[model samples]
Target: MATMKDVAQLAGVSTATVSRALMNPEKVSSSTRKRVEDAVLEAGYSPNSLARNLRRMNLKPL
Candidate 1:
């Protein structure tokens, strides 16, 4: 039962960095991307698509 926080902690970065690294790799550095990827594999992380879609659905257009 690994969480996003766990992945962030393992990667030595913030949760936002983990999200960016996962959702938008171009936004993160190569070294940070590698670290996040390694942490994801080590933590057996899996992004929850449904939750992400739901979150986007709830966002109001600016």
Candidate 2:
């Protein structure tokens, strides 16, 4: 599975930028958002929601 880092590399942007593009498109410029979106499709990246929730709760996944 392609990770966020892969998307970031493909987009030539930081992972934080990629996250912002996805979670809050308004936070990033239109061109930057487009780049991240294209990179996501090219890299086949899928966000791990379960892991994200775990991290938010300060828990580790088994």
For residues 1-62, what per-residue lDDT tens digits would candidate 2 score against the true structure? 89899999999999999999999999999999999999999999888889889989999999
Q: In model 1, what is the error at residue 8, expressed in angstroms?
A: 0.2
For candidate 1, what is the lDDT? 0.90
Residue 13 error, candidate 1, Å: 0.1
Would you estimate the TM-scores of all the predictions? Answer: 0.79, 0.88
TM-score of predicted model 2?
0.88
Off by over 4 Å in 2: none
- Estimate every model's Cα lDDT from 0 to 1: 0.90, 0.95
lDDT of 2: 0.95
